[model samples]
Target: MKRKGLRHILLPLLTAVMMLVVSACGSSSNAGTNGATGSGSGTEAASGASQEPASQTASGGTGNGEPVKVVWWHSMGGELGKVAAQLVQDFNASQSEIQVEEVYQGSYDESLNKMKASMDSKSGPSLIQVYEIGSRYMIDSGAITPVQQFIDAEGYDVSSLEPNIAGYYTFDGKQYSMPFNTSNPILYYNKTLFKEAGLDPENPPKTFQEIKDAALAINKTGKTGASFAIYGWFMEQFFANQGKDYVNNGNGRSGLATESMLNSEAGVKTLTWWKDLVDSKAAINLGRKTDDTKKAFLAGQIGMTLDSTASLRGIVDGAGTNFEVGTAFLPKADAADKGGVIIGGASLWILNNKPEEEQKAAWEFIKFLAKPETQAYWHINTGYFPITTKAYEDQRVIDNMAKYPQFKTAVDQLHATELTTATQGAVMGVFPEARQLAETAIEEAFGGKDPKAALDTAAQAITDKIATYNKTVNP
Candidate 1:
């Protein structure tokens, strides 16, 4: 699973941060927003004894020669970190031309912050894993090489990748990064609760009205019908579900985003629906943390909740005979809404500052990760669906699919999505801060403020932040 952190550090602080980084000697780790845990000791063990110099080789070596050393910085920790470490071990065992040292650089925020601090120095890793929202900042940083260059040079057929997943990383007709772990949100319902409430367990709610009705029925059973986390990510998903852009400039795909459309008709409607559910006691406000809602669902306190597919493994195991878990596509704002979800999770980016040979070696590791067999292992072990379409055909994936049929809902939802700007998701340098503002709006609405008024205030704040971001980046 993934996590969010305060990553919108101003440029002026880099000098001080860089100095501190140079003197810093210990590893740090933090839990992610996606329900994954990490240990500082595990981070130290994953990264190894000490950091390596950037220019370890005088020349790019290949095929039995001195191997090219490629350093990889990542945010995955705990069990996910172990899986990542195993993959690196497998890759190193598979080839002698490249050696990859996997480093666990805390959370997504810490990893990106370190990257920024190490930009002008040689302490940065050759390849880094950055979360989905960091795409805009990564591009604007101009310190990394676009994976498209390697793709074109090697004539790599990207057709094997899931289109919707790849669509998120593509900007200005170029693929900036190679998608690694990919996930989408889905509605997880308690099957036993549905049966108890006389709702059809097989036929889950698909629209706002249907969910509200289901929630009411489930509430009649003396349990909360739903407890949707007041997450900013879900707010964005609702806009996409209604075929509405969260920002202008084609959801920031066509060009730099200059405004926030969180106050659009779709946004107001979505918020009002959610508010109505809370007011009617059909659902409860669970604040901004998804973890709380997940716990509530597993404990049978809530009938349904919204969360990433990355949370499937833990949710299933946590339920463990207490209740049956049923998964469905995220509900649409209206029955006729045409858009779908945006992909979550991080992607792999190669640093331009690295030696060309090291970059090439890093590409090899990326290619290995994208292979069907590897992806299947990743999917089964980490709960993140594969980015490669062929991974679904692998026997392991097939077996795992049967074991947990609920997982297929996320896959179906992803494939069913239309590749539109809104569904592809919005991109902005100020996205992290914007999400916080969006969450604040949700809290205000739940606090009895008018939904439209709350959204308008948040949207204006995001617009001002966007303008400020544009000026600083483009100045």
Candidate 2:
């Protein structure tokens, strides 16, 4: 080579470097630009050890390179959690281009807290499953990207997704997260209890008064009447069924927090009904402390309940053969019923701090999950209603519903629902905290304070919280 190049290769000198490099070219470590590391992951190598291969990316619908690895955080506890874990494995096995890892934290709030901890350290999973109410925290924290943009860039067909499914994720007409595991509250009446109470086994309470009367009638049979848990969700659904919105800005789908409107007519009416039940000793106020009431229902100690469709699997599993768990649509408070209940399940959100290539890979897993067949599989395995129209029409969903008809109860409510702002959902800041406040408000109302006054106080507290959170979130 050049004399100057040779001068730099001299041993322990600049001239010696050329000779060393030339001789070492034949060595295995010199095969790649950075030592051609064998792509080992999960542990960093010793100092000067070559880095592994670059992270993979999804090729969208094209059957190109290896599937990307996407980490997911979920809280689909109990049997469904196992099913979701298996679904991830199945998807990873189904495609060579994408691998999904599902991690289960405990309950909904626990999962959110975990994600928040991740945010605090500037490290978080690529995908997070957040309930509808977590929108303010996720969006304001700037942790999640607007998923519709990712779908558009990747050319994934989103037209198949129902607008109603996407409706809850919209903020000022922009969609942040797509749909997953959406559900509405429904009445789970005990057939044997109903029969013993002289009520028709095939029929259930058609209105709030009817439920109260059923509770009173069933109470005579020595069974505690209706056993409602998750008082907030049940009450929210109860309000929606009566055609009243809970949160403002059209339940936060329109824009930032608007007004706390839960103290209105529908709200008071629903709480009044609950109060009446408590006063007449027709029902018991069960908080979120434990599933004691759930155990009571399964053990035939309680007659009816209002819980999520997500509970369907757990309730069935827990019931064993104690008594048949019969499902029905929620009752209306008004004489003229509006429609079905609002959506209440978690949706998967993509983190924005990821590298561009890794982001696309995560998007691949999301698109795979949105497929009709995949959605149907998820819905059948977990009692969540499929968020897509095609999923509802899928043959697998059809067959599964026949076997477990209760799976279709929430789906059926969708059809019966009237188009109203109430059914969309709520978005009060610190809504989780607000849920506790509402519970306390319910307790106060049950203690004989006018239902309207109790809700008004609760709404004022919620409004004050909204102001406080807005400052913390925006400042």
TM-score per candidate: 0.89, 0.81
Tens-digit lDDT track of model 1 for 1-475: 0111212333434334322332231121112332132111122212112121111122224766788899999988777788888888877777678889999997676787788877667689999998778788777766678899989997999998999999999987899999987788899999999999999999999999999999999998999999988777888889988889999999999889999999999899999999999999999987766767888999999999998788776788789999999999999987877889888778999987777888898888888888878888778887787999998988878887897889989899999999899988899977766777887898899999999999999999989877866765665
Among all candidates shown, the one with the greatest TM-score: 1
Worst 10 residues of 1 by lDDT: 47-56
Model number with the top lDDT: 1
Cα lDDT tens digits for candidate 2, 37-113? 11100011111111111122334433466556678887665455656676676666665766777887755555665
Off by over 4 Å in 1: 1-64
